[model samples]
Target chain A: MPPVVKIEEIHKIYDSGEVPVHAVRGVTLEIERGDFVALMGASGSGKSTLMNLLGCLDRPTRGRYLLDGIDVSQLDRNALADIRNQKLGFVFQGFNLLARTTALENVELPMLYGARKFTTKQIRERAMHCLDIVGLSQRFDHFPSQLSGGQQQRVAIARALVNEPQVLLADEPTGNLDTRTSAEVMGVFQKLNDEGITIVMVTHELDIAHFCKRNLILRDGVMVRDEAVSNRSFAATELEKLSSAEAAAKLTGAKT
Target chain B: MRFGSIIKVALRALMRNTMRSILTALGIIIGVGAVIAMVSIGNGAKAQVEAQVASLGQNVITVFSGSMSSGGMRGGWGSSPSLTIEDAEAIEREVTGIVGVSPEVRDRNQVLANGLNWNTSVNGESPDYPDIRSWKIASGAMFSDQDVRSVAKVCVIGKTVADQLFANGDPVGQTLRIRNIPFKVLGVLDSKGFNLFGQDQDDAVLVPYTSHMKRLSRRSYISSILIQAASADVIDKVQKDITEVLTQRRKGREPDFTVRNQVELAQTATATTQTMTLLLAAIASVSLLVGGIGIMNIMLVSVTERTREIGIRLAIGAHGSDVLMQFLIEATILSSLGGVIGILLGIGSSQLVSHLNGWPVLVSTASVVIAFVFSAAVGMFFGFYPARKAAQLDPIDALRYE
Candidate 1:
């Protein structure tokens, strides 16, 4: 199958009123369908800008970007918006759920803009199915403020998958969660990957990057390394180990 | 995005801040309300004036004698009787549009009837007086031409004179003594209420002009000629014809009379009321403008506050136009809602004002529709800048907005 995302020598420049800032300088990469990849970089490495370009939220300054075999770099604002709605989903570190909206409505947001028309019943059913996939079926009517941090991120993941996009782009999906909660979120992502959903996530932690099958590192707007993970960590097993360790610590404190 | 969903989203957003939305709409409410109320009052005043003019007489014109200069001391118009019974008869004979013409001679005198006395003006008029003045007799009949030719003292009593002189009975067939000359009441004139000048129109009596000329006043010339045109459209032409014929009869030395028509009086009254209404409506529209500004101000603030929400919607595949439409629809809904409420409030308040002040008020549907459309236009006009500002926001920048 053709690659779900293709970038050839893409460059992004930002005009900061004085000297121009080259946020992404001459980068090229590809990801096939169903591939689980993590992009890793330090601060100022231009990883976020690269993600924006790949997500079709921003156009490349020089070069072409093909999302699902279609060149999207030259599309106008409305066309890009349509492409984003039909073929892309994004998960942010902030969970970005509309504050007063319920989890089901948040999940339904992407489908509301989908290319295919959906009735209210279809929208509700599809949103409920996505919420079930994210293990948030019981929290469908709960608001983001009422949900825990981990659950809110799960709702965001459900929102990203509601439109059944070709690729899921997540930026620091676990940045605001505790260690065990991060592992729990990674477990949900692992299950999605096993079901043939392509995902490209950005993170700074090497340990979190190990949860993916492939890793790409950036340095100062350039690709520094690209390789398969020699020993990938299964999030389900890691989460089990974390909970057992916590249970053991609680037992020892109770005996003391 | 579908239109229904877009509206739903806008409604949701507005409901998130109900208090702010209501306050923003208040401006339009007051504006539309004031416009409707002021316009209604103006229309009512105009109608009242028209009714008063109509009551005086329909298509009626009056020819007043010119000022008389006696020994270089000039008296005002009608001070000298230049019009005559002959002139009134000539107008009826020569004018093509003249329906009826009556020579008038009036004097204030004490009228006694049924042992009760009242001070009233007694008018000596031709037999065609009732037809020319559009006056109807409640009972009995008007004096005939024979009555005028033979100098018969038959008269018609007005409603006010009837009530004051014959409090417990009808005045028709009763004897009324004017200038101590006993006159038989022929009929009672219909009540005309008060005129625009606040003068009681029914406090008068009508008699045969020959009777007044031969027996009471002994005046040879008549005071004025009350001419009724055939129709409203021919009033100006009739006035002109009367003026020309009178001038020719006087040998063109100088116009001995001034001709006036009710059409001119009606136009002047209508124009004044219309101007006042427009001024009031213009002042009321300022509030609508202020209301529009209120909407714009609130929309700007809402855009700034929802910067992150806009970013999220954009990232989720909302076109810039979608975001623009969302805010624009929000503003429109606010103003239109205000417009509807204002219409109701305006009508209610106008009715209230009419009840309290006893002033007639007519709420025209055209004005209501105009006020509504104007308010919606205000919403769209004032909403554009803020909606554009929101639409132009970069998705990447918006997502990062804290």
Candidate 2:
């Protein structure tokens, strides 16, 4: 079977200001279906730009991009939008759930703009199922403001998955969460990956990269490292270790 | 995207900023309201004038003594007394399609009756006066043709004259002294509120033109001749015939008379109100235009404020056209809703004006429909730029907008 995403000699340049910026130099990559990959880079390292190209949010300056076996690199803006709606999902760092909207409605938003028509009942059922997958079915009616940061991120993740897209692209999905909540969110991702959902996440944190099966690191607009994670961290095990360590510290303080 | 969803999304967005939306819609509301109110008041004035003109009786024509001419030194209508009693008699004999003819001789004098006195107009008319003027006598009866030929001392007193001079008793069968001449009140006229010229039509007593010309004022000629045609279809023919007969009677002398029909009277009376209505509507539409600008201003602000929301939608696979549709729907809903409320407000205010200040007011469905359509069009027209601006936004820059 062909890879879900295959990019050949992809390049992205920005001529916005006086000095031209080659945000992403020629980089070729491929990701098989159900693979969980992490993209790691420092600020200004063009990770975001590369992620945008992969998500079809922005087109590459020069390259061939095949998403889910369709060549999307030559498509117009509207066609790209259709590709995004039908095959690619996005979870942003800021948990970009529409404010004042309930979690279920936020999840249902992608379907509202999708190519296929859905009845209201079908949309509601599908959104509820996605929220259930993210452990947020109980908070379906809760607004983003009412949820904790981790819950809001979960809602955003549910929104990303509602379309059943082939690729889930998350940009710093846990950037604003605490360590325990970050681990919890990663656990959700790991569980989904175990069920054969492909994910590509971008993050600067080394520990966050360890949660994925593979890591690709960029520096100065070039890929510096591409390797399978040798000492991968499991979020479920890390969360367990964290709770035990907290229990031990509490016991020691009580004895003192 | 489905139209229903687009509308739902727009409504939700508007609800998010309820106060600002209401304020923006207020501009359209007031604009439409002003348009409706001004048109209604103008229409009401026209209706009042038409009703008053109709009171002069249907298919009626008037021959005044003075002609309207630009070349000669101007003397307004009724300035010269050239209509003699013979001229009225000649019109009655020669003119066809005429139902009634009355030689009107008007004078203002102190009338005394039932030990009371009042200053009122005394009109000299034939027995056909009541029928010609469409006036109904409340009691007794109009004097007979024999009374007119015999120069009877009988008269008909109007309601206002009756009220002022015979407050305690029936005016009919009583003595009404006009200019120190005692005349019997044959009947009392039903009240007619006022005429187009604001003259009190009911403050008058009617006597035979013979008595008015030969005894009351001692004048050789009548003031004007009021003629009623058989039907509306022949009023012009009747008027032309009267002019021809009168001109021939003058034996080739430059005719000193002017002819007018009810239609001309109505047109002349309503022309000012029509112009005023148009001017007011123009001014009101300017405000509606201002209101449209207000909508554009607010929509631009909303587009700026919701840039982040737009970015998120775009990233989630919303087409630029979707964003445009959503914003356009939002503006249209705001304006059309304002238009509906404004129509109600306009009607209510016009009714209040009519009730409180005693001014006439008419609310027409055509105006309401026009106001609604205009407001909606205004929304579409003014909303285009901002909606396009939102639709053309770069998703990357918009998503990153702080």
TM-score of chain B of each: 0.94, 0.88
Give the worst 10-residue stretch by lDDT in candidate 2 chain A: A217-226
Consecutive 10-residue window with the lowest summed lDDT within model 1 chain A: A108-117
lDDT (Cα atoms) of all candidates against the true structure = 0.91, 0.92
TM-scores for chain A over all candidates = 0.97, 0.98
Give the Å error, residue A139, model 2.
0.9
Q: In model 1, which residue pairs have backbone atoms overlapping below 3 Å? A: none
User: What does the lDDT read for residue B200 in candidate 2?
Assistant: 88
TM-score of chain B, candidate 1? 0.94
Fraction of true contacts reproduced, model 2?
A: 0.66
What is residue A48's positional error in candidate 2, in angstroms? 1.2
TM-score of 1: 0.94
